[model samples]
Target: MTMRTRARTMTALLALAAMTGLAGCAPGPIVEDGPGEAGTLEVQKVNPADFAGQSLSYVYFTDGPDEAATRELIASFEEEYDVTVNLEVLPYSDLVTSVQARLSGGNAPDVVRLTGLTDFRADLLDLRTYLGEDYAEEFVDGPVKGVLGEYGEMLAVPSDLTLNGPFINVDLFNEAGVPLPDSEDPWTWDEMIDAATKVQEATDTEYAFAIDKSGHRVSTVLSQYGTALVGDDGAVLDEAKAVEALQPLVDMMADGRMPRDFWLGSGSRYEGANDIFLAQQTPVYLSGNWQVGQFADNADFTWAAAPNPCADECGGFPGGKYMGALAEGPNPALGAFFVQYMNTTKAQQKFIVAGGFLPTRVDLTERGVQYPVRQEDMDVFFADLARTPDLGYEANSQPSYTGASLELVDELALVVAGEKDTTTAVSDLKAKSEQLVEELQP
Candidate 1:
């Protein structure tokens, strides 16, 4: 209700209050915190009045997170800014293509959405120019890089370094009589394949591995080799390195270790065959973090997170999501604000609670938020994310690199499809990828 009333609940000085209203439900109370929690929520401080009477259009990944509270917060911003904030959602695949077309056609949303690694690096306005001096550290580490151009300049503020990974059906493993690994003993590649093969042999499954040959899935395999899809030279992965990089995975398929057709083919239901896993037809799902919300909602079997299996030599893959800001928008400030807003500790709490996205902020992960109903579930994801090396980020593993890295994926498809031998595929991929990387390199 009243700000003063909200203040009574906080321990000390109250800088911000988040009031939520659910549809067809009574307006919920505000959650207020003392100083530094939300980094100055006082409307007077940021001057929501500055945004009044204006409409801000943000082009985002067509749709994500409709948590009533976030919408309520947007409404409050609208009321404060006196402007309508229109969110344009697009498919993850097409978000960039859409942004580029709009910018060229001059119909671009004021705010643009970018993957951590997929979108253009130089096209955005320099956020550091807007948030320079001392205000920058208030943001997370990943967003700080958004300003960094190809040679390293801050092009835009970061949205989120969303974590994506393998989803395991532990109950299915148990049911199929495959031994599940302990929390300490993460599965190795051979072990993962063996377990999947065993599950198929022991059950009436159509597929063992939840084949996803997308570059997203390949990141994990690349990581398993301690090889980043984009190398230190910042060129397309050496097709040789790319091939050698993904050798273990190709071998797994070649040896009849995992399902044959599912990954190498693009026709699978993109929403996930998690249903297959749910129905006990496919036991594992190699998917993004967003699927957690979907999984908890539909899964009937008792599933658990297994440390993503890795190559025998290297450890697990370091997962970094793609996110970015638009070059132009109806509300550049607010678009920037949303980028900041979504990546904040507060939003991360909601992510863990709502979508199971891993927090990129080390501080948040170490001192986790209490937003999720399933703390245990959050804890497991947090651990899964923590095991990843910081080197992945330093290696420039932003989701933005998805396109350039995909040259290798195209080659992998040929390998698995029997169109090309693994050796030739890797060798050819290395050459083509090197050229692409040279073109994309900073």
Candidate 2:
């Protein structure tokens, strides 16, 4: 398949909360804000002197049915502004199509939720003119890049940026007598291997890392090699870079750097990678900053994070998940409003404290987004995100990312089952991927 095919839905990613109800939204699954107590996202408020009267429309993906906190925010915002936002809520899957249809039909809502590049492309409002100069430059490229349309016009604003780094079980490291590195000093892949081996040997744990979900595991490895499973266009990928990124995991597993039984079917839950690190089953797990919540929730262990390992030449483990907007919305005005609203330091600070998602722009992170973990650890997570995150577009960005990444099923199974060496297996896959990218680009 071509890159275009791989560009969308990498999360399974993509979603906008509200859209014109005249049409429907994704019904595949919706995560509504549950009965988890109504909590407030600390809002960065403006002094009344600088505030203006403006009503806007907002569409959001409810954790599921309407979330009380979201509704509460809507009420609060409405009371404060001449801005009357017509709120539209919808399912995740249908969010894009429904909003596109509404905007095409001249009924687009003012603001909508967004996922990847495609959403921000096409016709979303550009925030460059609005912010002027100083404000825009403060953010890192990862968040800003996701916000653009065709011409680098700022489309949507990011509320948070998800970044990955090594989550180290300090207790395990200490027990094993392994020297823990400072967050500022990142590990190299070789150093990581030695350290992990030492940790496992001393503790008798079966793994140095766990693969609860391979999302973080795979992306960082691929970045080192210079290929990604998806391309900038959001399409299926086959590239030399991808081969480089993936080879080490195969090697690490073979060398017993990780648990032998930790492949996809190992029953490790998707959200539990953090728990694994905490339990000391693994000494190091590549994880995102959103995990600040898990760290905050855990008190028994004295764990901390280190920056993601980097190759000698290039730096940063690619990050995933930045917010954006749909080009065509039922209401462009409201869409633009949301774009501007969400990216502000105030909104991001709110997301940071509650959800543990790292604020994308340097402006917000610098101000100290809340987390219960050590100040030094939080600094490491943000540095990685700002330095390097999201090396490739998500599956939806390139439709083929999911399917193409999936194509390795047979070949990977071959290697995993011991039928092939890491070199031979990846070599064969690399040829196919290179051919595929060539076909997609032309």
Candidate 3:
């Protein structure tokens, strides 16, 4: 099917386009205007005719609607510039390892799509010299920070933004006679559990909640409880906060409100909870906005995105991918041009609208993109993004947090599976994370 045709089909499948409120703590001051208002700089634009016959290679993962949108962008670029782009699409599972192998072999693609730039910063072309400092201001702050290196180098161009929260089975709530919380009034952690219990008893669902078995997803609870995977000095997860963050999942499992086999299930480390959710075995699923498209296209029951339950505060990990030029690539000029071109306002709007993604541009966030489907769910997601605490942004942007965060997930799994008590698990995690952070330091 054509890209536009597929988008239209996805839209048709998404018949529930009603706006929903998202609950969370208030956000810090944010720039509500477009990046153009930030500033302007006179930077040299790429003259496509300068290298009409030049060839460039680009690599990226293929998934969902993005693959089609990306190909459309490449076709437009290739046609306009009169250059040949050897586009290499890899499966999500093979993307990172393959890119690393190629880079190690000194045969890096001219431009590549990356989710995190920190590890690749040393080998990435610093774009500030080409795109100008002013150009960087055009994107949203959270994503910009994610692509910025420790020495203030622009390692990548931010292309999109995504945030995680709760997706509720609306029909189950109605059947359970539990009132949904509005954006103005979000439920606290205890309150959410109370409501989930009601839904479980009334509906006899196999599980009340099933969170994605990802460290990033679990970090939302840690962030909401006013802690991060890594602190300013080092790894600083206190026992109290650790228990406060992890105990709820443990308690839910003990009460039979959550499936013990999902996280601790007999499967690979990559096992997911999305299957249980899609089967309607769970009333709530804690995942990122990426699931919106899948739920829209595949769900047989009514559902809506809800604000994350708050403890001391409410927040979620800010995530998105970026396009970066390899410093060791065949053509730096072409790579830089493509990176900047792909993130331009027009290009971002086209991709965001076509791919059903949240825009990385502040202005696009405020003005909104014309998503072919799930517009209302997108609204709740944006609202949740706005309320996310600055600390949450800080946590995800740090490279050191990567290893520590994974350890947190593994250790927490042990706790959930009753392999280790919360105290022992937290202690071991704290020490290991601290060591990992120290080892990662330059």
Q: Which of the numbered candidates is closest to the native, going by highest lDDT?
A: 3
TM-scores of all predicted structures:
0.76, 0.69, 0.87
**Per-model C-alpha lDDT, please?**
0.55, 0.54, 0.76
Please give the distance, in angstroms, between residue 208's alpha carbon in candidate 3 and its true position after superposition. Answer: 1.1
lDDT of 1 at 216: 55
Q: Please give, for residues 177-238, the per-residue lDDT of candidate 2 as tens digits.
A: 99997566677777877898889989988677654355434555666545465566543334
Rank candidates by TM-score, best first: 3, 1, 2
Q: Kindly provide the TM-score of model 3 when superposed on the true structure, using C-alpha atoms.
A: 0.87
Tell me the deviation in Å of residue 182 in model 1. 2.1
Can you tell me which runs of candidate 1 are displaced by over 4 Å?
A: 1-48, 62-69, 80-82, 91-94, 116-120, 133-147, 150-152, 236-245, 267-275, 312-331, 371-374, 394-400
Cα misplacement distance, residue 102 of candidate 3 (Å):
2.0
Pairs with backbone N, CA or C atoms under 3 Å apart (clashes), candidate 3: none
Off by over 4 Å in 2: 1-57, 62-75, 82-109, 123-138, 225-245, 266-272, 313-315, 318-330, 365-373, 386-414, 424-442
lDDT-superior candidate, 1 or 2: 1
Model 3, 12-95: lDDT tens per residue? 322211110011121222111211122222233334446578989998885578888888998987776677888998887787
The global Cα lDDT (0 to 1) of model 3 is 0.76
Total backbone collisions, model 1? 36
